[model samples]
Target: MKRIVAGGFFLLSGVLLYLGVHLAAAMYLPHITGWSTPPGKYGTALRETGGYAANLFSILLMIGGSLILLIELYFPHAAATYKKALAERNREYEKKHNLRE
Candidate 1:
């Protein structure tokens, strides 16, 4: 449906946004670090010219975004699984509270 497509687009947009940020960072992250300098500060951003931080940031952001998008894609099923687990724990809690095996 339209809603599903819209949601898919949103997830895709996140991926594209991450890539764009990474690409832009690759192009100019050095300037920001240079401006922020004492001399050895922003260590990770220094050695390889900020590529490390940019790549690391990109990877972490990508992973987190992908995980969120994946969960969003499976939202109803994800919610069901969570609810099932919670209900099981609740049942255990109630049984323990009642001192019933």
Candidate 2:
């Protein structure tokens, strides 16, 4: 189960990161990649409209995806340690208050 969940997260984060890069490239370097918007008055060329919004979203996606991937890959033990510490603290608090877990 744990391995399955980790694999799923890895796939999800990879897709998100890929999408961010693809969007950024399409927006800024359409010529190099040969990506462009449809022929219409709204978008005269590549990345002409909603440039700021698209840029912001792409940045967010990249950051979020990378953070998630890093945490899952490098900090799995950190989460276990944190949970143990939290439980210990809770037990101490309960003991001080003369309460049972």
Model 2, span 5-45: residue lDDT tens: 66556556556655664565466544443433553332333
Superposed by TM-score, candidate 1 places the C-alpha of residue 30 at a distance from the truth, in angstroms, of 5.0
Off by over 4 Å in 2: 1-47, 78-101
**TM-score, each model?**
0.35, 0.35
lDDT of 1: 0.61
State the lDDT of candidate 1 residue by residue for 15-51, as single tens digits. Answer: 6765765565556545554443453434433444545
**Which candidate comes out best when scored by lDDT?**
1
- In model 2, the worst 10-residue window by lDDT is 39-48
